[model samples]
Target: MHGWLTTPPGPGPHPVVLIIHGGPFAQVTVAVSDETQVLVDAGYAVLACNPRGSAGYGQAHGRVIRRRLGTVDRSDVLDFLAGALADAPKLDAGRLGLMGGSYGGFLAAWLTAHDQRFTAAIVERAFLDPETFLGTSDVGDFFVEEYLGPSRALRNAQSPQELVDRVSTPTLLIHSEQDLRCPLSQAERYYFALKRGGVAAELAIFPGEDHELSRGGTPRHRLQRLELILDWWDRYLPVRPAPHART
Candidate 1:
């Protein structure tokens, strides 16, 4: 896996936030990320990695996770974080949080359900249930079968909603009302299951937005998204002050 880590200017340990990019086949480049900047400004060490299924790494790397959504990609992400933490002692592994959108959101939900290490998670505009996603998403007809394979059992096995019974991490689900690519029900059903299972969960549906809300929505909604995201992280995995700071 290839990635980047950005941290606030300091020589002390800092809370870490793992960010997973949307496309299972997309890559995370070294560039100015407004979101990461905000989180860093709020005193976080942000880790963004391009795992096994990401592009710009070659064809084999991209195809390695085909019909294998949660396995290799999951390993790559965890391993990347592990390596990051090991190499950078200044990143506090104990105060870890995760957030992702689209396919990245699927992995975020999948990881929180399987791993108990993260303090909390933000699942935004996720592709959670493969079965339902087939019928609802704009590209579901071929995308589901192409990626998950043409098997009902396989889809369920890889579905976060179906396996949400195992999730314990506090989660915040965010989705747009007009996201045809992922759709709103993706977040709704997962939120419902999280609640029924007694996990700390919250769902926020944007009134007039779509899958691109974070990138292209009106400035007002985008700012609102940033605020809510920081709020969730602050409540769940707050950044501790530098030791010498005065109140």
Candidate 2:
């Protein structure tokens, strides 16, 4: 596991936001982005990483999680976060948040259910139910076959919907109504299950937007999305003001 960590200036112990990259085979570089800067500026430490099954780490590492969607990748992320917290004493492990889109969004939901350490989560364009997703998504069959193989039971077991009842972390779901890749129904089903399970969850839908909502949506909507994320984190894992400013 490889990652980049950025801390806010003059911080003693800061809340941490773990940003997971989208593709199950993609890599997260050390580059800084406006989105990450926003969190850093607001006094949150941001940690972005490339876990196992991510590209740029050779073919063996990238293919290690094949046919095992939620198992190895999930453990890799958890281990990476734990190691990061251990290395950085200024990071507050108790006030942890997770943010990601697409495949990463799926992991966010998976982690929220399997782990109790995360205080909040921002899930964008997530794939919640493998059964439903196989029918609705444009790339459903290919995605399922490529990553999960042909086992129906295995797919259901790995889907986020199956574990929604265990999620207690406050979650904010951002989905694009016109998204054909993952589809909006993914978000709807997850939100419904979360509500039914008594979990703190909210869903935000962007009209006329697709899977590219975060990367190439209208400028106004992108800004709105960032604001929504910030608001969610503030509501759940708020960054306390500096001592000098408090007085």
Candidate 3:
């Protein structure tokens, strides 16, 4: 796994946000997003990584998660995060949060359920129920069989919905109303489940948008999305006051 860690200047220890890139086969590079700078400016340390299934790490590494999906890829991310925290003294491990879209959102939901370390999560344009996604999404069936095999039980097991009962992380679900790729129902299922289970959760559905809402949605909506994310983090992992400057 490869990644970059960025921390704000003049910080003793800062709350950290793990930014996971979408695309089960894509890689997260330093040039990929300005969101890292956004988080840094907001007084948080950011760690972004390209785990095993990500591209640019040889074909074998990228294909390793094929037909295995949630299991191996999740482990790779968690392991990478552990190593990153160990190496970065400025990151506050206890005040950790996560944000990701699409496939990254799937991982975020899974992590929220399986790992209690995260204090907050932003699951954007996520795929929650594999069976439903396989039926409703544009490319669902193909990717489902390609990543999770043809077994019904296996697909259900890997679905985030299966573990919804266990999730306790304060979560925000952002989805586009017109998205056919992951669909708004994906967010709906998880959001409803979280609320029913007494978990802290919020849902934001953007009008006239699709799966690309984060990347290419309307300017106003995109700004609103960023504000929502920042607000969630501030509420859960509020930044501590910087040390007072000497006179």
Candidate 4:
């Protein structure tokens, strides 16, 4: 229910991208990501939502988000769209986009599967299978125990893998080859499902990098990856009235 919004300069009917930050407990808004500013500068409206589960809002909301996961947070997203965009007359509803990494990615994939409101999505190093996560990720057991309770069945019920077969939006999956936390296989499996479902999906695996790539990396590579994301949005989720000026 709490977040920030950014606008592109000299814009009318600009596209909007919903930025979902990672962490079952981390406050994405406080952690800070250059992508938010960059995307805003690129002439798109940005709605950064720190929903119920986010840490900054307090402990209670965080616990609530963890317990319900998709059920509550998904509705939060829907409400966000209703309240946040209602004031922006230039916002393009048909071109709505979702971008998230790690936990955010899972949410994005979940939204893609549960709803058709989004036209495009960018998922980075997303976790798909909680059962597999317990095997592959170093911190999986901790999160599973901390957030979703101790039940294995409860964990699977919240995982994106369980629902990816239903996703229809065009999605771009990006993960680092060196990502030990989420692993490349995670993205691969989701990408496979997207393709199998006859959905438009593309996977980008960054070599010699880890989960930290999105947070900080060589300037050139960082810009390159960011550009690839923007390009993907432009290609598939272009606004009805394209901005007249683009660098």
Q: Report every candidate's CA lDDT.
A: 0.93, 0.89, 0.88, 0.81
- Model 4, 79-107: lDDT tens digits are 88778778778677667889888989989
Residue 16, model 4: lDDT of 90
Cα lDDT of candidate 2 equals: 0.89
Runs of candidate 3 exceeding 4 Å displacement: 241-247
- Which residue pairs show backbone clashes in model 1? none
- Order the candidates by TM-score, highest first: 1, 2, 3, 4
Name the regions of candidate 2 deviating beyond 4 angstroms. 241-247
Worst 10 residues of 1 by lDDT: 238-247
Q: Residue 188 of candidate 2: its Cα lDDT?
A: 96
Give per-residue CA lDDT, model 2, range 1-247, as digits (tens).
6888999997559999998888888888866588899999999999988888899989999898887878888888888899999989999988899989999999999999898888889999998888888888999988987787788988877888988999998899999999999999999999999889888889999999999988899999999999999999988888983357553
RMSD of every candidate to native, in Å, equals 2.6, 2.6, 3.4, 3.6
Winning candidate number (lDDT): 1
For residues 1-247, could you state the per-residue lDDT of candidate 3 as single tens digits?
6888888997558898998888888988768466788889999998888888898988999899887777888887888889988987888888899989999999999999898999899999997888888899999879889888799998887889999999999999999999999989899989999999999999999999998887888999989988988898888888874568999
TM-score, candidate 2, is 0.95
